[model samples]
Target: MIGVGKMKQYTNVLDKPLTKGKQEVSLSAFAFLFSELVQYNQTQVDNIGELERRLEDAGYAVGARVLELLCHRDKGNRRETRLLGILSFVHSTVWKVLFGKVADSLEKGTEHEDEYMISEKELLVNRFISIPKDMGTFNCGAFVAGIVRGVLDGAGFPAVVTAHFVPVEGQQRPRTTILIKFAEEVLHREARLG
Candidate 1:
């Protein structure tokens, strides 16, 4: 066998310096890639709901990895434990990183103690999607919902995360709301912590 020199390894991911500024994913570029993801998933599912679910499942993995990387790299392995802290992280930190800005609103659910709502006037995924009437109201926010679930669940705050389109009184298009319902244990823990 011919003699081969050992390949030198570059700096580890943890050793790299954090980004100095926001990395912009242009709307056009993001739209193209997101459309491709939806199209690729379209072939695999029989119906719109399945397609959305698959997308959500795919996003769940991405969210889980994102949490791990951010915790280790950005936060120096510190993770948010409180409900509000994690929600703020998702609303501000995660949203800023992914969508280039903080979400429009983060509101406590009026009817429920365990629920919260994260609303965006124009969600990144919904901006790129154009579903037909026959297909029904298929909100692409499901994928984002999965991402939130993954982040919360990975951080030890298990919850049921979902997305819905709520109408805006004056706007022609509806806004997306990511609804998170915390598990019983999570609520209990929050009570204890309080």
Candidate 2:
């Protein structure tokens, strides 16, 4: 209404309730859409960083919405206030919402003071995507990292999330590790409030 002032008011089409039992979408459809999204971003960038950054930016918005919806739906509209509590929510609940399954692993950094990791075997975002040699070191999992960053940031835990491809023994597919490094201020707050 703010931008389309002269247009006649149209009935809201999204008012219908989601009465269907399962709210899942076809994986094939998701793959196609994600491929198109990657292609679109690829065309707009000249370097790998720009491409990954764009993809991450797109996911950031979705993650913001997801954080709100997940908190409202699963946490009874309450937000997690502790470090491990929030990480558990992300590793279990958020992963389940996005991939229909929990993440493979969640671990704290032994060397770092305030760092965490979420690993996924065969990340859905990279399922149908193949990185070109020219793109060198580019991984589509950055989008998922950005989503994690967005969710953590929105929940008052500012962090930097990066995705890396790790080869797992006895596993045919690569594992994607999302490294989350929380800000010093956030760590201080977590300690003070924890």
Candidate 3:
């Protein structure tokens, strides 16, 4: 007979099947809402960077909470340690938990071993982001970067995460790439483990 905790775990897994289909949402609704949010922040923030930072910080809070929930649900019995292992966890587990799909690509920096990159062509939040000439400095993708930072830090791989738009051939929408640079201590630990 299963204990109460074991029963609850089984019920949770069964009740919420991992293969839940993606739900369609109105892009216009999201865009209008996001535009208003940006406008509202504009008055309170001193500059564009500060507004981006606020969005990033909001994402960081979401990421921290999401990470805790994900770990509890999927990896409750185990913890991640290695760099590549954690990277995979982020690309797959964290991505699915947050965006409902795994990232398009995850690459390690060739020149710098401590850096990793997650690239996605169509970022969800940036789907309808069209910065006018006056607001050329704004890129809402900083929120995504913040979420990545939260996931990495929660998994014990403290790092710096930044989001940027990199154009690729044959792609209309800009490719949003998240560059993650692990601190020196993380690299040293990885070396010791290897």
Worst 10 residues of 1 by lDDT: 1-10
Candidates arranged by TM-score, highest first: 2, 1, 3
- Inter-residue clash pairs, candidate 2: none
- Which structure among the candidates has the greatest TM-score? 2
Which ranges in model 2 have alpha carbons more than 4 Å from their true place? 1-21
Q: For residue 106, what is the lDDT in candidate 3?
A: 97
Q: Give a tens-digit lDDT track for model 3, residues 1-194.
A: 22433422444554764442343445677678867877787888988889888888877887887777777778864657889888888889888766678999999888998899999888888887776777665678888888888877887889988888888998766788989999899999889998
lDDT of 2 by residue, 1-194 (tens): 13345444548846543222355777888999999998899899998899889988888887888888888777778998888888998999888888889999999989998889999888988987777777777889989998998899899888888898888999876788999999999888878885
Question: Please, what is the TM-score per model?
Answer: 0.87, 0.88, 0.80
The lDDT values for all models are: 0.86, 0.85, 0.80
Q: Write the per-residue lDDT of candidate 1 for residues 22-139, one digit (tens) a residue.
A: 3554678777888888889999999887997898898888789878877876788999989899999999988877787899999999999999999999998888577688878788
What is candidate 2's local distance difference test score? 0.85
Q: Candidate 1, after superposition: displacement of residue 7 in Å?
A: 22
